[model samples]
Target: MGNHTEVTEFILVSFNGQPQMQIVFLLLFLLMYTITLVGNAGMILITSCDSQLNTPMYYFLKNLSFLDICYSSVITPKAMVSFATGDMAISYNGCATQMFFFSLFGTTEAFFLAVMAYDRFIAVCSPLLYHTIMSKKRCMCLVCISYFFGCVNCCTQTGFTFSLAFCGPTHVNHFFCDVPAVMKASCSDTFVNEMVLLVVCGLIIVTTAIIVLVSYIYIVTTILHIPSGKGRHKAFSTCTSHLMAVSLFFGTVFFMYAQPGAMSSPNQGKVVSIFYTVVIPMLNPIIYSLRNKEVKEALIRQLKRKGFETIMDNCSTASEFILVGFRDLPELQVTFFITFLVLYITTVMGNGGMIAVISADSQLHTPMYYFLKNLSFLDLCYSSAIAPKALVNFFEEKNIISYEGCVAQLMLFTIFVTTEGFLLAVMAYDRFMAICYPLLYPTKMSKKSCNRLVATSYACGCINGVIQTSVSFHLRFCNLSKINHFFCDVPAVMNAATTYTYLNEAVMFSLCNVIIAITTVVIFTSYTYILSTILKIQSAEGRRKAFSTCASHITAVTIFYGTVFFIYAQPAAMSSPAQSKIVSVFYTLVIPMLNPLIYSLRNKDVKAALKRTLGKKRLFSMNR
Candidate 1:
């Protein structure tokens, strides 16, 4: 291959063969880029403005958000333009600049996440010494060191990548000048470049990953000894969001670059890049805000100080909405109605019974049952929000919902669902404390703390509901008002919009996934520690009992999240309206009913409480 010194500029062949998809790409990228800016900017603003968030954890979070903004801007704006205009050309110097900054920020973010893991470990594993260990001076030193290392790493890789003679085609088969894509364009023997790339990038990734892994190993071990279940839960919750962010960020980067050869096709590489660059930046703020109660509370306080009415005024919209429940299936209408009616009745009986049992029984009045009571209440609300309307719509020729009605349903449904997610996570934490930190359960899960946790769950749910409902209805529906699903869901309603739904979809996708991912992380993390503790127990019976205690909640979580991910996380093109409705029924109706049964049947305390209540009723009847 001959070196072409005259080629002053390289063309970025981004989505070149598919001209039809360019507009879609342009709109999507533009929306994502805008959100990336707003979310990261908001994170930084809130952290700076709030005094409560002045801890080491948030200090790193602030920097991470800033890094996300910078790295995302490197590729997103240019990619959006490339999609909008046909001008995909980039000067040699321009490409090098982009490559340098991209590497700089990307490497910095990776190191930052690892540093965050260390911060969390210190906080969870050594709370008394955390302030001393991660002092302001040390934190600043760490941040500066991260950037210094990032600069050195970026310069080393960028210099080598660009130094290669680009004698071959100047058309880079990527949205931006990524290290691999640019290297592929070099005409020289690039074995040394690939080796340098593999060795250097591999070391950075592995070293950071090892730091995180080691930190969590200690963190989990420390959490397991917390005498109170609440204490263990609180310690674990602090790191859940960070773990989620790390998994997403490092997982994608590892897949993209951690290979001896080109890992995948260019198209696949571009898709992976899109996630880490465009999607992850927009997600960091949401992940942190949703998982961190302090951040959420800070946001609420800030909003209240600015006047709640202003926020409400901006969010208020949607006069009426017609729910296209189950489409036109008159033949199965009666069957569907009967099926839903039975399911609804069963849900009420099950969840209602659980609530009644927990409230009446003195023996069941623990932190665990306190959360269970909230869970039951949320299940009742969640079911009522969807099931009644669904059953009514099954018989009606036209499934119509007033605008206010739709908004109300959406709000109630979102609140309960979101609250339930957090409630389940809280329950998992409670179990972890009970099993792992049995000695501290009473003090850690006091009445005051339990009440606070329940209150926070509901508050977080309301906040999530308001944001999701507002965003969904804010879109101009035009004439397309008929929702495909049986109830008003964010995705279904967003899909009904006649205008470009990319932004709406992006927001909805990011929000739902963040919530789901955070909750999942908390649950899994709690269990990871719980399982470790269980294995160490000397008695098999004790281990069995501990496992049994978590069985009901785990089952309930699996059924609920499995259905949710199937409905929301899946690509819209692959799922039909009918498929969505069927899955929705399982979660909305069937799971609520099953939850009480799973708890009651498997739980010794619940069964004992039920027997006592039945015995008293029989004795009263005999006296009568």
Candidate 2:
């Protein structure tokens, strides 16, 4: 800060280190932020959903989780941007706003933790009076008081800190606009401001810290007098998490603000600031989750309800498999993560857009769009089965999958892939009927028959998936099994087996041949007759129209078949694991991305349907 007329903004100088350190910290910050959000959000969800967590502890805990989210959000995101972009200037009002909310949430969290300590004190020290003392109305009032004090504490510190006259633009030495950093940057006399900040911070910290200390003291004293050791441990365990959380929050706030003058230099302050701001918020939920038996049981109950019961049902590692994905190519892992992330997003959006267009436009309710919708669904499932896991594995050190997870991934991927093949064959037959026998097309390919054909396609794929997964998973494997690809593939999984897998291999290979041959026969026969019929058309436009309909499907089929045949049918080339993994990615991820684009660009009906859908929206909006 200088002797200027008016200060406009502040430049944050924290985290502006060497490029290498910035990158490291950036990744760490991102991972911490993600955990903070997911963990806090999960605690919120568990408390809200689970009846077991209906006590005063969880009620305040839910609010504390939401407060942690708001607290971390106030600073971490902007710091992440500063790390990424290197433009760390924040406007004057923005700085004040950041200070206000950050202080508010921070102070509120302190008070909430204090309240939680008191709740545990009552639960353990006065079990009979717990309900009467911590009733709903009283709990609400306590929370409101926490917020009210948070507001007052924030206003006193933030207002007094900013009220000091700064002669020049402020340059904050920290990632965020903290009171200490702002005071350091001020040109005016900050003695009164610093005294006020320290005094205010001391009162809040001492007040809340005393509540936590006294509560735990009473809790421990009560537990010590219990006749049974188990009872003593059970009672103390309930306060353990709250005690740890209080130590972390109050310890940091006291260190940063309760000191007489500046606590430390800018660099040390920045490093310490990260703990309370980013790390503690993320750690609290995890600590609670691990320590609290009820929270764990509730999490398991929730998971089981969501269909993970199958995974949770088995405890053995007999079916576990590790995915060996991009482990050897360490240098290119980041590049691959970015590339596949983009491809996955594109695949989902493209296929989803096709489905939306088909459903919205009544003109697309014909047999072609119906089949197209099914194809898009298959493609979407295909990519989702592989890409999400594979993308995550790119950055992870050990790409482990449970036996149930591997089985499910392989099962779903097989189902989607096989169904697409059969669906494409059915699509060829639909095109053949449309071109070869236009008069009989609608009657022969009636709604009932079309439904039967699609269902039959799924039935074929499901049967094959069951057979494939059953055979592939049965073969014995090494103690530590590793599948040599991004996601599970039949060939990759089979190759990892330690036992005799000839029968498994034979069955898998034969099924692949049978699927390819059966679909190939249908598609080839239909397209052959349709080709002859199209050649005989008298008009060029008529021929072009017929070819356009089949072009997209043919392109999709050829690419998919070529990929499948190369990866699975030809076992000789499987020795080169790298090449096989590459093809597996193309087969699974790239095809989905291409399918919707192929249809939307090549088929007149899809484009027209999309346009009509958009035009309807525009007109509807104009009318409104």
Best by lDDT: 2
lDDT of 2 at 357: 92
lDDT of 1 by residue, 19-60 (tens): 534544664565557667867897898888888889898899
* Tens-digit lDDT string for candidate 2 (1-624): 334338888898886653323433553576568768867997999999988898899999999999999989999999888876779899888888999999999999999999999899889988999999999999999999999999998898888877777755568889999989988888878888877887888899889989988988898789889999998888888888888888888888887888863456778788789999998998888778755778867765665566544322333345578888878888999999998999999999999999999988888888888999999999999899988888888767789888788889999999989888888988988898888888977777778777867887786688678768866876556545888888888888887875445546666776787678767866897799989998999999999988887898889889989988887776675678899888877878888999999888867777788888889899999999
**Poorest 10 consecutive residues of model 2 by lDDT?**
308-317
Each model's number of backbone clashes? 5, 4
Q: Model-by-model lDDT, in order?
A: 0.82, 0.83
Off by over 4 Å in 2: 1-5, 17-20, 261-264, 304-624
Give me the candidate number with maximum TM-score.
Answer: 1
For model 1, what is the alpha-carbon lDDT of residue 382? 93
lDDT of 1: 0.82
